[model samples]
Target: MAEWALIFKTAIALFAIVNPIGVIPIFISATDGWPAKDRAHTANTVAITVFIVLTVSALLGESILEFFSISIPSFQVGGGILVMLIAISMMHGKQSTTRQTPEEAQETAERNVIAVVPLSIPLLAGPGAISSMIITAQQSGSFWGHISLALPIAVVCLAIWLALRLSMHIAQRLGTIGINVVTRLMGLILAAMAVEFIAHGISGLFPSLAS
Candidate 1:
């Protein structure tokens, strides 16, 4: 039951951070003027790319931290700050430069193959998302625990794909104001999660505070 609870928490956190609904506008813009088939293909590619990137991060992130001698607590704090920044940006109804800079956005417009580059890499599976997964992976110590993280990752990716697949309909239905409202709501949730991450990290670093 506890494990299932943890998985549910992880899924919610990932969904809030990823915020596929929030990315619908960007997805629409990127695939603008493309054929329906090509657009669908881009959506599929983005989903697959995000799943692979996050899943790999979950498995290898701890080793990478160890290699650099960066403790999980330190990473948690740093990652928490990063996530908080993203949350603030989302609340403002703007995409974070941390996820993709103005240059990348321009490049995305100029490029034809944007599914993996700006869309999946930074736009969806950005540093904040990666860091969150790493932190969760570290907490899940067992092999099965680590592997189970994939389930949520897969679910999130599926959501991403579905959002992108129906991007046009969503954009038309939600409009700008509606989308912004959703983004702000997700941002609020993400901000709370970020606080938790920061608090937990601080407690880990300073055990005395935990008491």
Candidate 2:
């Protein structure tokens, strides 16, 4: 049915926005010293955090923005800057530097917060996702429209879970080179998304700019 197609489109849009593949390097960095037994736990924790943040944001971020008199254009500009910086870092093969600052000669690795930081915030529920969800919801005034958008959010989280769960297998098969390739490719995608956000902001800022 038409409704199913809408859901599929929403899922793809969310998938592009979430891009689990983009977060792999960050995940590896976070779990660098974690025991093998704990890797799954860490990934699950990260995935769960992402799910919670994104789901909440999807449901209420718009309300919060409206209540605060915040503009999506402002978020578009700020979020675009953040995503572009992260994308550039990923593209240059330095994801560790992209999100968290290094521990700096090992006083003690700040590994505990990795799941919540780069993994959960920008990686999953960052500005791009939050903005996209708000826009999608507004566009989705009807019941089916809401369902369409919600399906994608759920699917994106599911993809994250699967990716993190299979991280070991993925790393083994891909090797560093493969992971690098995937990282850069995802970076390119992220870069494009960032451009869209910036454009959205700028367009809003100057109605006649791009026109």
Which stretches of model 1 miss by more than 4 angstroms? Answer: 107-110
Model 2 per-residue lDDT tens digits across residues 41-125: 7777877887777666666766788899988777667767777776787687655343434453142244456666657765567
Model 1 pairs in collision: none
Model 2: residues with Cα > 4 Å off, grouped in runs: 1-19, 22-38, 96-98, 101-147
RMSD of each: 1.1, 4.1
lDDT of each: 0.93, 0.69
Please give, for residues 65-121, the per-residue lDDT of candidate 1 as tens digits: 999999999999999999999999999999888998888777777776799888888
Score residue 81 of candidate 1 by CA lDDT: 99
* Residue range with the least summed lDDT across 10 consecutive positions in model 2: 99-108
Superposition TM-score, candidate 1 onto the true structure: 0.96
What TM-score would candidate 2 get against the native?
A: 0.72
Error of 2 at 110 (Å): 5.1
